[model samples]
Target: MKRFWMAVTLLLTAGVLGACSNLGFNDSSESTASSGTKTATYQTTGTVDSGMYQGVIKNGRYQTSKTRGLATSTNTQSGTYNIKSMENGLLDLAKKQFSTSKYVFQEGQLITEATAENWLGRKSKDNANGLNPASNGKLDEDTRAPIYLQTLLEQDFMTQSGSKLQLGGIAIALGMNEYDYYQKVKYGATYTTHISDAKLVSEGESMAAEIVARLRRLSGVGKNVPILVTLYKNAGSDALVGGTFFRSVLSTSGSDLGKWSTIDQQNETLPTVNNAKPLDSNVSTDFSDFSEQIENFFPTLAGVTAQAHYQDGSLAGLNISINTQFYSETEIMSFTQYVATTAQKYLPDGAKIEITIASTAGTQALITREAGAKGFYTHVFGSY
Candidate 1:
């Protein structure tokens, strides 16, 4: 037993001397306020086909309250894949840059030798007119091409991680997001791809090793303790762009990757209250932007709050409550349509949206039972 302890100590000493610096496990570490956690930033440069991307990964440690004499530490990682280049002609550039067979450019947006045949497959005159290269406004191939690239890169990243790591629970899925500007590809001559705030939570052996090592080095309390990893994007940028949560165990799951669990930050029950006032800061982060947009639409808006309900990490439905002075039936209808369309973009397909409006007189309700493609109001019903 004495010899065994000595050998174990020697091995750990060697490991500390060998890789401590590379792991950034130095003594002088930055703390995350009250939590006894540390933060580390990781960067990787890689090429997808010919297009190069700079991947940024940020990690942080967290510990929730102890339960059954076990305190678990949660570690999170959030990432972004960015591409920049001086390229023109979106479709041509995509074909030259990416390794994909199906680079299908929607008709009426891009013109080619096959444009006539593609146009012939349309269903109606309006559809045909909509595809006219001259009539389609700026919805051309140059702009839409980057969207395809973004989608491809995002999927590849997820697949790569899935194959490499053993994650726990449900893996957090990335959302399809469109920025107001695409740097160069859309409105200008240059082309760039920016995919932001895809999150991965670590649960399993990967997280277990980290906690055990840290505990062994510090005070030796981590044996078999649960660890959480909450990867938050846009931590320093726009609040709305990137704050998806993927809760995974930090320890290894006796496998390559930790088990991951997807969480809807906005999925929660509303606190019971008597007043019909505006919701407080307790509003879920998911609905933060929607609340702000509504307030801006009506400066004198009384109160606004939104809650999202989820099942198995999938958005099941949405509930929004708003209090304002007064608006006509037409105005209310337009507002409901607008909200339904906007929320649908960020929500899963087939998810429902329920909107409740409270005016000075009474209350009204609206429901989009079937939010359409692009979140259009396909089936809307309203009642006072």
Candidate 2:
């Protein structure tokens, strides 16, 4: 596990250094094999350039999923943040259990787009294998059954065997809707029906069991492969942040799922507003102090905000954005230095921190501090 994190840190550091040197961050960097065999390389999905990394094999030409574009088409989430969160969040969780050193990552190849659409659609005479409950001819929230399953995501993990790679494990994420939005008729006003947390989890677990059974019946996926299934409750369209994964189950053998585990993860915007849940006092105080220090230095700045991620009730990462009006290259560099210093002073010690300095024109600088690292990496954009 330590080695896995170290590799990630090195990759991130290399990416930042490469970006600073005028080379594109996502540019391919490959390692050659002494035996003249193809080796793994870092790759990113072309669909979303969000900086999430995947390991590719065979000269970096890993097989692309047949249903490549289905995620955007089938996803019902209205917010782009939620869509990205659902996909990337699953990968983050899977990394904890499936170390990158041993297992290579690949996009899902078994489930086709048609199968995904059918599973997401309402069960009817035509689509008997649909996972969602059949809809009745009613629009009222009281009588109509809310659609529980919003979208399905799958990620495959491969293991190397002397120049060959085979499927070793699979991770699947189910994105469930917290509120069901529907219209009574065409061109009619849409109404939302809230689904309780208890109901969502109950439905998600049942769907997961059936999904495992179906996966076992697939051609490539057999009964013995280990599978991890996670359930995520998506936030509403108006939410400031994405939703969280509440529960997950692992199946190592057979079609049955193993004992479920709770994922105590949450995301909160810093400088709490609207009487949000109280954060850890130390973290909250540190962020408050950090914000104050920045504001004191540059009072004319538009605003300072942060999105903090928590895992198992502890701060895991923070992404801070600083909006300023200054554009001079030297001024931006000085401000970046000061911000990095203030962040080192006031930010929590164990969490990874990233600070982005931006102006009305565009992004001016970026500063990143790895978890438990002593120094920060600062880069001012343009010819600085």
Candidate 3:
């Protein structure tokens, strides 16, 4: 465990969502998909969000509370895989770089390229676009990619109780997101790939509720549990990489993603030794020009004040009332400040800011959801 954390930090010092598959929200482009430039339609299916996606993490802990009296659990995860999207030309260039390397997850262990191709790698024309050099924008976890943090839970992360694993290690999934800006004129949409770990255990609703009660005591909640979203572009080969702002969604499931279907809508082609581009760090998300959006903007949360009876038959359990309080803020500015000084792990370069207010109990404010809102409505953060 110590070695894993150390390795991640070192590699991270060096550099480094939603709902699909076990990971959630996969944009698998099928054979029927259109060209890299052609516009397309999508459909979706999976778990209904129901605000469960609006989570807040404090000191690296996520306090999860179910809508109704249901099972409570915790999850953590870490793993590695690359989802590259580019133009046909750039993908060809990148393939050469991957030749000597078979996409290693760590020091010397080489994962099967065929396995990666079927699961994480591209196999079709659309999937190939993932490695193409024509990409005008970076991948967006909110859109093109599925939130596989949960998907990889079984392998990447282990469960303590929810779904017990007798031999695997603790699963802890981390969410690091990046947004793209160049599409249409520059390209089309977003692209993404990730690594995660998960550890989950099921508990009585009463116990789950009890945990939620303890979380209420945190001061300045929103200050600690904030999310960052970025807009990056010009990531493709020199021929087509231009500039533009892009948008996507961070969700648990695409089951009800309006008309957005996650399966088989992506460019499935991949880069080979003969066709690939050099992988480089493009735009930085933690820039002063970007902004963030928050969902639950609570000022201070003492926790859910409720009566415990049915949630758990245990007399020791207390009833918790989920008195829903709403806050909206353009927290981009303040959040960026915190990330610059404290969150060196994610926002080492620093990010922009937007003000968002969702809820307030006292000095502690709770932020439910936050993301990078770039476009005509880009600067608009928080729920107004």
Alpha carbon lDDT at 3, candidate 1:
9
TM-score on alpha carbons, each prediction: 0.25, 0.82, 0.16
Evaluation by TM-score, superior candidate among 1 and 2: 2
Point to the candidate with the largest TM-score: 2
Error of 3 at 236 (Å): 4.2
User: What TM-score would candidate 3 get against the native?
Assistant: 0.16
Which candidate ranks first by lDDT, i.e. highest?
A: 2
As for lDDT, the candidate ahead, 1 or 3, is 1
CA shift at 146, candidate 3, in angstroms?
Answer: 22
Global Cα RMSD, each model: 24.2, 10.3, 25.5
Off by over 4 Å in 2: 1-54, 57-62, 73-77, 275-277
- Model 1, 1-384: lDDT tens digits are 010000000000100112111332112212212121122532222223323222212253111111201101111111121110001112222333222221111111111213222221212344452111222223333433222111101111101121121111111111122221233233345333343333112212232343234333322112332222223212212221122233333333222235544433423433323443322333344456566566666557647655544445555555666778756777666666666665554434565666677687667545455433344433323555
With a 3 Å backbone cut-off (N, CA, C), the pairs that clash in candidate 2 are: none
Instruction: Choose 1 or 3, whichever is better by TM-score.
Output: 1
Candidate no. 1 TM-score: 0.25
Question: By lDDT, highest first, what's the ranking?
Answer: 2, 1, 3
Candidate 1 C-alpha error for residue 329, in Å? 3.4
